[model samples]
Target: MNLFENAIKLRGFLAEDAKVPPSDGITEDAFSVLFLALMSGTWDIATNEWAPRTTVHRVVCPGPWFCGFTRGMKRGDYVEVEGELYIHDYDRPVVVEGERSTAKRYVSEIRAIQVRKLDRPLLVIDTGEDG
Candidate 1:
């Protein structure tokens, strides 16, 4: 299942178990990451809509993988994805070399959704039904 669906299932299980660890465990971190990933589902696919000016990254395999930049990449500069730090062959995903505004905004938006709203659980994986 996708991150959201899995989060929902995991959340259900966690709620039933009184033995769940205090919220400071590594598992909690993992859960938080999962939550963010699920929250990013829409943006990941439609990133062009979010940052149309930015270059689109084409992964060799199917992916909506989260990429962290060591430095703000500029056009023609090389970038590394996953953990291949030594390989600088991957083209950076920005039209302007040092423009991190769009990328930062995308991430910040996802974070905003998570932190600003606390009324309901955000644990359902997107099935392309809700946009």
Candidate 2:
């Protein structure tokens, strides 16, 4: 037997408000999508310093419960998300080198099973000068 698993956990700030599309009357459950920005530091061996890096990720909150939970989140809010990774592939029209064409696009997103808002203060820097 072969065992497989796909899981991801991320801690970051909400890049924007949760996006929930209006119900189409086909599905009873509500769905939501969120953009999160994760920041980290990368160390450079030669430079002997650390550099900041930011990555934005798309998170999907499916079902009425998850959607409702995300509705309270807003931009700049720190949050933690736990979920599974999913990749969606679709065709999109594009113009490459002045030629119109259709291309296949792949989008990787996290299907969130758990989300939590963390109460943390933003970093502040003081220059010691008062105006």
Candidate 3:
């Protein structure tokens, strides 16, 4: 499922059992990359209702996969869903990216949510129904 579904379905599980994973390295996958791209696109999709300007990088796949990397991804870090982040999976329909060995499995504790910045502008994940 995508972020929206993760929120509605996976979040419950995270809060209960998804041990708040200690910051660590992680791998990545195609699914993770695609998801992030869609999320990045949400910004422009919300403002304009027509052909967009400048081919923006809605999302960027961080390559086929990385070996030893962490979630230091900034607003422009071609992310590929770096395994489990700071989640507390409590056994629910959570989305996991596997584990740290290859990837850090994770569940969306917070999805389709906004940043806590008064002027940083809002960010929305377009978790379409297809997910």
Alpha-carbon local distance difference test for all models = 0.24, 0.86, 0.28
Q: Mind giving the per-residue lDDT tens digits that candidate 1 earns over 1-131? A: 55532111111111111112223442312222112111122344555544223323222211111211111222332222231111133333555666643322221111111111123444687688676
Reference-based lDDT, residue 21, model 2: 65
RMSD to the true structure for each prediction, in A, is 19.4, 4.0, 17.6
Colliding residue pairs in candidate 1: 4-125, 5-125, 74-97
lDDT of 3 by residue, 6-75 (tens): 3221111011111112334332432112223222123356666554332222212232232112223334
Cα deviation in Å at residue 8, candidate 3? 22
Candidate 3: segments with Cα more than 4 A from true spot: 1-20, 23-68, 80-131
Location of the lowest summed lDDT over 10 successive residues in candidate 2: 21-30
Candidate 3 versus truth, CA RMSD in Å, comes to 17.6
Please give the ranking of all candidate structures by TM-score, highest first, separated by commas. 2, 3, 1
Q: Is candidate 2 or candidate 3 better by lDDT?
A: 2
Q: What shift in Å separates residue 90 of candidate 1 from its native position after superposition?
A: 29
- List, residue by residue over 18-43, the lDDT tens digit for candidate 2: 88765452155667999999989889
Between candidates 1 and 2, the lDDT winner: 2
Error of 2 at 73 (Å): 1.0
